[model samples]
Target chain A: MYLAQIHVTYKPSILDPQGVAIKDAMHRLDFDTVTDVTQGKYFEVTLSADSAADAEAEIEAICDRLLANPNMETYRYDVKELANQ
Target chain B: MYLAQIHVTYKPSILDPQGVAIKDAMHRLDFDTVTDVTQGKYFEVTLSADSAADAEAEIEAICDRLLANPNMETYRYDVKELANQ
Candidate 1:
């Protein structure tokens, strides 16, 4: 078994309203030190696989098909073996 | 400067459609070993801050305001010094 950590984020050129909102909130909260705020998603997946290579292929397919919005977002993943499971 | 790695994931009780869709895709791709696929998002931020404490507070504000869906998602972050920047 292995664990896959996936990340999905908006493309840099795209406007992130959520991030903008956060920045504005910070300004109001007296944290003037915050200049920019960008928001993204994170996932941890447990894969019941026999090998890392197989898990990688499966994870890539997952990203290409559903984990990311091809037009506005990009995805990446890291896979590590489960030491006890 | 420091780098903040943020992760956002759906609450376990909440249904994750994106994750389910990825699982189905994995099955179609002939990787029968993949039994479950949960999807999430990740972000790397470069913070121009004087210390890790300030960065932590800033990042927490980011999460409470925009990085997470308070009703359905959970968020976490790690901050590290940027050695070269």
Candidate 2:
């Protein structure tokens, strides 16, 4: 088994309104030090693949085709082996 | 400035229907190797703080009060100092 930890985040150019709202909320609650916030999605996936390289390739394909909206987001992932699961 | 990267995830005992849905979608799309999927929220918050330890403490407070549901979810964070921004 191999496990993939993926983070899908908005591109730098994108404006994140939800992040702005969170910052404002934080300030209202007196966390005045908060300056900025960026929100994103995290996924942990477990799969069986022939090799580490294969697992990474599969994860990339999954992100590109299903997990992320390529026009608005970019994703990065780490893949590692899991023994006998 | 200090940056805190946070991840909020469901407790292992909690059921993640969205994750199950995503895994099913993956399999239907022919990615049968997928065995499990776990989805969570990710955040990057930038704040002005006196020190990294203070920043981490603040981040933990924010997570406990706002970002996570104590009964269902748990959170972890990484804090680091950033060059003048």
Candidate 3:
């Protein structure tokens, strides 16, 4: 099987209130060295595909279609082969 | 400045409803090749630290204290130096 690690993040131009809140919380907690924070989604998908290329194609389609909003967010993924556990 | 990309994910034993929902949604959308999904948090932090080591230390502390639930989640991070843009 192939496992894909996907990261979907907001475009830099967008405003991220959750990130801002986290940054503020960090300041409140006394970690003022952190200047900014941008929050996003990370997904790990296990696919029943024969090859990494096949898994990549399926995952890219998924990301383009559902995992990320094309307008406000962008996504990237890495595919790795997994051995049965 | 240093930029830290942190990934916080649930332990393998934990249930991830969000991931399950996304998998179901993918099935509904006709992409059944995906067998399983796991979801987590991705954070891009811009820090005004003197060096990568310092940023890593601070981020590790932040992750331990506020960013993740130590009992339920495991976290990892990558730090990179960003050139002024």
RMSD of each: 3.3, 0.7, 1.5
Of the native A-B interface contacts, what share survives in model 3? Answer: 0.96
- Model 2 spans > 4 angstroms off: none
Model 3 Cα shift for residue B38 (angstroms): 0.1
Q: Which ten residues in a row have the lowest lDDT in candidate 3 chain A?
A: A46-55
Off by over 4 Å in 1: B10-32, B39-47, B61-74, B82-85
Docking class of 1: acceptable
lDDT of 1 at B43: 62
DockQ for each numbered candidate: 0.46, 0.96, 0.86
Q: What is the TM-score of chain A alone in each candidate?
A: 0.94, 0.97, 0.94
lDDT of 1 at B69: 85
User: Per-residue alpha-carbon lDDT of model 1 for B1-85, expressed as tens digits?
Assistant: 7778888888889998997886776677666676676666666656678789988988887778766789998987899987973
- Best-matching candidate per lDDT: 2
Alpha-carbon local distance difference test for all models: 0.77, 0.95, 0.93
**DockQ, 0 to 1 scale, candidate 2:** 0.96
* Comparison by DockQ, 1 against 2, better one: 2
Relative to the unseen true structure, what is the C-alpha lDDT of residue B26 in candidate 2, on a scale of 0 to 100?
100
Best by TM-score: 2
Ranking by lDDT: 2, 3, 1
